[model samples]
Target: MRAQKQEWYASWFNTPYYHILYGDRDYEEAGAFMNNLTTALSLQADSHIMDLACGRGRHSLFLNKLGFKVTGVDLSENSIDFARKQLEQDASVDSSRITFDVHNMTLPYHDKFDAVFNLFTSFGYFDEEQDNLNTIKSIKKNLKDGAYAVIDFMNVPHVLRHLVISNSKTIQGITFNMNRRFENGFIYKDIEFTDGGNKYHFTERVSALMLSDFQKYFDQAGLELIDIYGDYQLYEYDKFNSSRLIMILRKQ
Candidate 1:
């Protein structure tokens, strides 16, 4: 049977809350998250950074404001367009250093960056695990000799501990609903959206890949796991206490 999680976001996330959840997101929390985490990784001031799967340029713009040369890449043309529009309206401290565009995360990039970031559980999308590996391969190709990559992932244990089997919310006159259920290390999400006589629904499932799984993928992609953080506060990752896992990786 087809999983309920794949279409969950697609069907329900195109609304205003979708933009709030994914695109048009304010990264104050996430930017601070990146700042402290990158500091821990010893990121330089003028580093060339790539925000992979960057929706509406949250992290990209954040780093740009912080004086890093940043490139925001994503597969969503709609989101990219929105980001471009937003960037045009904002006055940047280092305007020339920021760029946002559409790109597939699963493919190789042209040049190397000092750092690469995939944040907010935005890394996983494909149905197959190798699909995720392809993205790791792309990241490996995008990093320079000494730079690193960081992935902000959810704490699987926390999710399991605080698993809400179902939930719902409203945004912009649209009713957004979600149902989450896990089986065999996969969290299946079923989502539905309704707005003014129109309705949509889809399913999406993400593998609750463990730290060991991250090790395997990073090793296979010629990347090394140098550090891991538990949350935005930049604390050490513990199985039960942390709500997220932030991993810092380097090319091997």
Candidate 2:
């Protein structure tokens, strides 16, 4: 039997501690960005949208609230379960307009959505260069002709410029020690924490790909780069100064 390759995200993201560690994430900021983006694009009501890597359906819920039909796909079964439960329990959400599924982003889905979103620096997790490229190709195959796609990623140069080497924070009685480093074209983070008299550790790695790298992938995927933004406000891109590289691409 062939050995199954271990992916960092597969283990780290499945644990409940992952949610606890990142529980303080700025949902308000994320919601603001989504609002700004949908408004900017003038998304029509009832348009079909795919939230690629949609963890627990936070953004997908919001998108559905805005009247778009949303399909939220994540690699983690736990996250997909949580999203499904949320959709079932939430009274305000149009449950029929939202769905959740477990999926791998590197595989192609044909002609299904009017828009696709891979937000919050969700790309570049694969160790193989071709796997990373395959994700873009898969995304291209998922969209209909002339449909828009949004990729919200960190600006590599800006992230390195402002990189904090280490930090410690306590949440819900667990103190998490986090260390960050850049090496061999990848950004790496080591996280350690203790709870209930047990210690746990995990590592995260993502390719430190720049804007030009994404441009090349888009070209190879037969997608056209329509616009680039520096931040959620959608200001023009400034590689050195921007907090994010938000690319708006179109399936050509």
Candidate 3:
């Protein structure tokens, strides 16, 4: 059954992962990651890249630093606004080399790029399975004739084996306890946030489609998975050993 996209990452992406993934040390990891990816794709600095679901333009910023013409798109208005602010503050690169736009990824894109990126398990936020399919097609639409697209996702078996079903957090002095559950391919979580003043709760769901299933979507979109990585390094994917499944797809 197809699920509805009720719990999108409009605000949640600005949480810890956002700050952690874009910080200086995080940026170093990102540089290594981009270097690995670009080498695997055999891309040059002149390549045009699209950072799909590019929250706050971190990847795009790095791509721009590498001299790639980058276009970043996301559905979060706040994130986009902040991305623009970051863009404005950046004096190291030519301002026109990097651009950020606001749009839902479940539709066709007007322009094609030499490379397309969907990092950090951003593919499954759309509740309906077809939305994911459309996102692939949309990426295909925006990919140049002989370019590549990459997606990074959590490895299901590993998560199931090492899953912490519940945990508590204190963010900015506000504490929260979270409970997680697995159903079908979705990881459901209950986030109960409590401050000294108030309490709030919310639910989030992320889908889990295996590598083979993703290949099906890639085939539907006229793409082929050329490589797979375990986490940030090139290693074999294991049901329990690998933390992530990073797949690189090329247009056929």
Candidate 4:
């Protein structure tokens, strides 16, 4: 019998090295972005929010602190476990207000939510075009009528213009050498590192989807694009100069 092939994200995200490599992500900026986003949406207190593809519950916990009930879901079991552990250790957190689960983004979550957020370039990882469409459809399925969903994606053109082909970073005593390239409508990053005398390699591949591509998916998914922003501050989207492509969609 042929063994099942593991997906890149499933293998890479489950490893402890993934967290160690990206542990320095800016929490303050993320919190500020969340504040801006929630305020813009005019979310009322106690609104139920879903953090789709939430890793380690940073945004989920913050949303809970802002008085919203939050559900954080991710495809990685290890990530969900870490999030649950964090919630368990925090005595100040209201345990009932937030929950985490392992789930595929392409599948419809059982419960609908007032708002769903997929942040930090979390979309476009699937190899199949249908998977991308399915993810949008699932997001629409998870939202109540007239409810909002945000998809935070990287601006492919801008990123390509500024792409650093090779770089190295030493974090937590581990040096990760990364080589990046854009080919065949996908951005590929090959990461190599050595730790405890063992060498490891991983690759991250994301479809280089543009605004027009997303609009097509949104239309097919029966969603309406309500707004577009370039950055976490919610600036107007500019294709040439924007750092990010943030789309706000409403279930139709």
Candidate 5:
């Protein structure tokens, strides 16, 4: 049988240009968020964490540094390879405490974890709404009984309120032109650029999901929503003002 066609994310996320475009991400901020999150979750010192859609393993590595055993998975093989290479180059980290693999978030991971995290707006990429619910169910299947799961996503209202319709950024001598629009309950971002004598275009489509929408998905997936936060600081969520919609859930 012929192989199934890959999704847009599988192709785009695996590209070197994707890494270049996002290379300036704030790692310190990410680390601080992880610190606050692990503390808030009350994870044990030896807790096992599943970092779903953990591109390049930034959060996974930091979680490992915080004394947790971390399993980071992403659909991008290039990202997983990069994460593994970084792991091999870091001498102070105990390799046994961390692992990186390429896996689909919609499928149940084999090993159960004490806590599962889908961070940095990593959710809501599927064209079909059922896939999003499947991802939630998969997370439930990957968690031990009574364990916690977290999903950090963009606040749709806030994003739409502050949306810049068109913009451009120059990175690594490449100028990327970007345009964004919201239609049919999805946020679409079109990116165009030229590099190495070639022109490229990519589009990112994320469902504009709100708290109520997520509540329905969580309920359908047999998970209970325990808490809601607005940002990396873990403040109470405000529908219009917050930058992030962070949900903390528990398997029912």
Candidate 6:
């Protein structure tokens, strides 16, 4: 008998435990990258931007604060809901300038945005390789001519070199035990956590894609890779040691 395969992100991303596990992520670091990226793009205050696969609209909100009209979209209903709530609570944010929606990245959106962003390794979870290409094509379809895109992903080589097999952490009284492995060209993380005497489990799998893979996909989608960065600080990409592979692409 074959084992059942599920879309891990759909379940895990919507879970409260998932947010708890990652709540300590560095916002200052993320904000610095967003700042540098917006400056590099030289986008106007009125430019429309799409935050594809935006989780909770953190980056989208920051971009909006910087004066861009932003739309943040995510497949996770809970995440979108949270983002909307956050937006409502912030009185300083112009409601008309920012919006959040539930969306699947593989679908088309048409020419509506001056820029599109996929940050925080928010890609590469589809079961079919074609779906990944479909996502790139959708990004292209959603952009106006000469519009730009930013994709922030893990550097496969760097991750493989620093892979930690197992670890445990306790957050908010919940103990999370995690195990990691690389198999069949995918890195898998298995998470088991206990909260309030209840045990929950989840897994995340991401394809170990190199720069060549992205170049091929971008070419097929009619996007030109304009620049590559190694980290949030915008250093030149070093395939051997970079902590991240951040590519800036432009739609032709």
Off by over 4 Å in 3: 1-7, 10-25
- The list of candidate 1 runs beyond 4 A from truth reads 1-17, 20-26
Stretches of candidate 5 exceeding 4 Å from the true structure: 1-3
Q: Report the lDDT tens digits of candidate 3 across residue range 1-252.
A: 645443456556545434432343367777778777777778987898999988777778888888889889988776778889997788976678888889889886788899999887777876568878999999888888878988988887788788799997665666667899999878887787755566666667888688778889988888888878887765777756899898888886
- Candidate 5 has what TM-score? 0.97
Candidate 2, poorest ten consecutive residues by summed lDDT: 1-10
Pairs that collide, model 6 = none
TM-score of each: 0.89, 0.96, 0.88, 0.97, 0.97, 0.95
| Per-residue lDDT over 1-252 for candidate 5, one digit per residue giving the tens place of the 0 to 100 score | 535777888889999999999989999999999999999999999899999999999999999999999999999999999999999898867799999998999999999999999999999998678889999999999999999999999999999999999999999899999999999999999999999899999999999998999999998999999999999999999999999999999976
- Superposition error at 120 for model 5 (Å): 0.6
Top candidate when judged by lDDT against the true structure: 5
Candidate 4: where is the Cα deviation over 4 Å? 1-4
Candidate 6 residues lying further than 4 Å off, grouped into runs, are 1-6
Q: Model 6 over residues 4-35: C-alpha lDDT tens digits? A: 56577999999888888988888788788889
- Candidate 3 whole-model C-alpha lDDT, 0 to 1: 0.79
For 1-252, candidate 4 gives per-residue lDDT tens digits of 535567799899999999998888898888888999999999999689999999988888888878899999999898999999998898767889999999999999999999999999988888678989999999999999989999999999999999999999999899999999999999999999999999999999999999999999998999999899999899999998999999999986
Q: In order, what is each prediction's RMSD in angstroms?
A: 3.5, 1.5, 3.2, 1.8, 1.5, 2.6
Cα lDDT listed for each candidate: 0.79, 0.90, 0.79, 0.93, 0.94, 0.91
Q: What is candidate 6's CA lDDT for residue 114? A: 94
136 Cα displacement, candidate 4 (Å): 0.4
When sorted by TM-score, best at the front, the candidate numbers are: 5, 4, 2, 6, 1, 3
Residue pairs in collision within model 2: none
Candidate topping TM-score: 5
> Candidate 5 has which clashing residue pairs, if any?
none
